[model samples]
Target: MANKNHSDGDLKGTFYLVMALGVFIVVVWGLCFGLFLDRF
Candidate 1:
């Protein structure tokens, strides 16, 4: 039971990590895209 709980926590941590990374990437991409548009 303890091991299962630990694994569940690990899974949740991994999910949050992936979500944060995805948001970061999207924000960066949007900034770059906006700058690119400004050039025109």
Candidate 2:
């Protein structure tokens, strides 16, 4: 039971980290694209 709890906590943490990273990537991509368009 203890092992299961630990695994669950780890899984939750990983899920959140992945989600945050994905958002960060998306925001950076948008900013880059905007700058590229401005250069034109």
Flag clash pairs in model 1: none
Model 1 regions more than 4 Å off: 1-7
Candidates' lDDT values, in order? Answer: 0.97, 0.96
What's the TM for model 2? 0.68
**Candidate 2 ranges with C-alpha deviation above 4 Å:** 1-8
Q: Write one digit per residue (lDDT tens) for candidate 1, span 1-40.
A: 9999999988998899999999999999999999999997
TM-score list, all predictions: 0.73, 0.68
lDDT of 2: 0.96
Candidate 1, poorest ten consecutive residues by summed lDDT: 5-14
